[model samples]
Target chain A: MTEKDFELAGIRTVEEQPLRAKRKWYKEYPVVSMLFLGIMIVECFFCEQIMTVNPTYMDLEHCNVAPGRKFLFGTDTLGRDIFSMIWYGGRVSLLIGFVATAISTAIGVLFGAVSGVASPRADAFLMRAVEIVLSIPNLLMIVLLQAVLGGAGVIGISIVIGITGWMSIAKVVRTEVRQIRNSEYVIASKCMGGSFWHILWRHFLPNFWPSIMFMVVMNVRTAIVAESTLSFMGIGLPLEIVSWGSMLALSQQALMTGSWWMILIPGCFLIVTLMCVTDIGNSLRRDSNQRQSNL
Target chain B: MSEILIDVQNVTHHFKLNRKTAICAVDQVSFQIKKGEILGLVGESGAGKSTLARCIMNLYQPTAGRILYKGIDTCDRRQFKEHKKMLQTKRQLIFQDSTSSINQRMKAVDIIAEPLRINHVHTPRGSARAEAEFQLHYVGMDAGCLDKYPPELSGGERQRIAIARALSMEPELLVADEPIASLDVSIQAQIINLFKHLQKEHGFTFLFISHDLAMVEYLCDRVGVMYQGRLVELAPTRDLFSNPQHPYTRTLLSAIPLPDPKRERNRRKGVYDAQKS
Candidate 1:
């Protein structure tokens, strides 16, 4: 018989109308999309303020200016606008955090899924390697790597964080892959003479989506915090780049002189941004849990 | 003399526990199912009936012996791949727990249409949804079920949907592995009767594996008794029940509590054994 004539006699099909209804919630939430849109808009409009500020423009004339029409949210000892510094500083921090998290999560999911689904012998070997990497304190490993790399720019620090951050996500994804590989539908696909690659892409990946999503959101927050810590320690992006971490670092000397704007503005921005991300991540996690429980 | 649809010869399957020892799940079991015949494989939980079914479906490979489908040897790996689509189209399995067997994430129509899509059966002419609905109606379900997931349906309804999925492929043979064993006892008869009605209308062979001999006796044309990886007896259903050759078969028959208290009391007294002799 022609390929078209071979009916896989027992597989069921869904009617179009109901499938749309079943998938309605994914479209309705749009939380991730909204966050992404908000980030893009802020980045495009507010990134110019950091470059415009003359860090050495010691405006002794307007130093320590309180919240006023001329200088909104007051001026630092160096006479930079607190509001302007926050908007610009936020751009680099968010960029590094998201990029690092994306890189780490992608590496983790791919490696974990492959190792988990590979032959048992291969899986054992890969898992041992993962365990070794995980045994090292993550922060120490990133610090050591940054020291060795030396040029510790934004890209360099991001690479260091990305490499260290993937270990935990790999472990989670490996566990998920092991569980999904044994599902009946996967076995059924193998029985139907599907290729290994086909099964991996079609069955394994789709089933791994929920876990991958959870890992991605969790890792983004981790990356943001890790970037801040590194920057505070003088190992993150170039000293010239006005990131949240660099802002915090610059504010330290001024703190003794009690120019609170140096520390308070960047600190508050970091807290608010982290809170927003955490809220969205927690909501996604809750939704995933609810969907699983309902199933 | 019906045409032979499936011929399983000396199929001995073993699962390796280690280098030295193996679990003999199905040991040299042989049977032939004829077109339109319902061959009941009655056994206890560990009797290897399901393993034999899996081997026939190519889900599990037999360590030795061959399964011949319509005179073609199916045990050859190359031949199996070459004829994979044909095998799937010609043979299907209905698992015991309808809810677990059907994908919970999939809607009823997509579950039914999966086999058709996989085998590329719905060429240019028929829509998967239309074919799914037709098969659902064939198993006494309606269009409403198409929109629902497996979790949303009652046990009987889910089983019906499973049956519809199996029937959609238009297979010549179906391996129904304890299809109704998970349903409510009240719904068991309805599902059993539905299988019977479908067999009558579709004229497909069935290898019905179950521990319930009474249901098997009512539904099967021939019956095979399996005990601890061995087929102890194989005969026409009437002959097997009325004149059971295997001790296990006799035990199964005697254990069926008669509906009448008087008859049941007499059966307890070994009166049925005497009558059988």
Candidate 2:
């Protein structure tokens, strides 16, 4: 086909794909995601009350129980119901995950757009600065941040993770913006004497939206997993805070004794929640890629 | 044709690809476009026609030399912004690739009226839409085209929208850079006819850039033939066509095929070859 036909086909695909994919997304994933999200949100608000057998009010009387009626998912070695800990643990893990991702994504977009649209000298300088930040190992720096902050609790850990995690998304946005700067629409806008912000809003951002969606979803996954990993390493959250990683940290010794509830319950929740997040992200990726290829 | 519309003198554009390398795209190009005259610039693909058009519009900064619009030095640092606004209102450019030049996200009406909106052409916002409708009609598009996006329109329709947009400003001078290059020959003819009609009706000054010598001959008052980065020769359209001076111009002109199959079949008698010239 001719280039015009190709472009015509491209515009059709771009226009049509989003509506169809959105329908598909809701049909296949939204209900399930809503269910998972509902459960998570419920846990966040009422973890204390829903735990029927409150985790703090340990029952030494029913110690070492397994998947029984009175204490569902069984009781831990200390007789705290494992079910309650899992729900409460998710509160901090999921919170840390989302909050950090948000902070990092905001930082990423600002720096990325700046780097992308800036002059060559400024772009080089900004990207080099990004490179320097990216060069440092993520986990190592988070550990250092934790130590330096002296157990700054959930808030501090989230801030630290957010600060460290923005580079990749920033780089992605920068590259996308640079590509956008060359497109005919941008050149046309420049010819029309559009200001920097006008071009960014009208041309760059609209075209960059799909990719940004994908990056945001992916970053959510990274931030959540990183928080969990930090908790497992025993350096992410404070000892007082209950998180999936903190539970895992406490379960290490119990693993040798074969009392796996402490480890098994929280780990399962982490895996399940992460799986749901990845599914949402995958759908977003497919949607964005479909639109991107059309362009 | 008495007063000069655009004065481009000794202009050069050197693009630095890297810190250590640069390429001169336009070298010491001097030209004048008189009021109510269409000055056609014809050249090979890399002959800097588009670059010259861009420089004249102040869309690009030449490495050296200056452009004057009604005697205001457009390249002057302090006056660049002042002149740019004047140029934007009184002069405009229509590009080769219609699809690329028009924003896909915008409706045809919005695209046509964007210049007016940016420059605040009308007092109230609603009147801009009216002006846009008027422009679309001016370019022979119906009122129904106002709501349609660029992606939904055909190439010819899109170019019409671009022309409408450029003409909406009611510019005294319009630089058309290969405006018909991307269209089919039939559509190219129609657009050319429209441009000629508009020019004659309004006495619009034009800087028409194209590789199509026949189209240039049909439309322009004077034609400048460029090869590489320099103007090889320039003359009135008839003189340049009938008594070509530059070997490059002869090479370009000789390539145009005769319309009649009988004559075209035997038209290859004394082809101008560049290497021998």
The TM-score obtained by chain A of candidate 2 when compared with the true chain A: 0.81
Specify the highest-DockQ model's number.
2
DockQ for every prediction shown: 0.16, 0.30
**What tens digits encode model 2's per-residue C-alpha lDDT throughout A1-295?**
6777556443554344444334564575556865886688687668878887676566889877777788787876667777887777778888888899999988998799999989999999999999998999988888887788786677787898898899988998899899878776677667667777777777777767777786687777787788888877777775457778877886776777777776788888888777777778787788678766786
TM-score, every prediction: 0.77, 0.77
Candidate 2 structure lDDT:
0.83
Model 1, span B174-219: residue lDDT tens: 9998998998888999989998998998888999999997899899
lDDT (10s digit) by residue, model 2, range B187-249: 999999999989988788999999998899999999998877888898999999999988777
Question: Chain B vs. true chain B: TM-score for each candidate?
Answer: 0.93, 0.94
| lDDT tens digits by residue: candidate 1, A105-147 | 8789778988888899999999999999999999999889988
lDDT of 1 at A248: 83
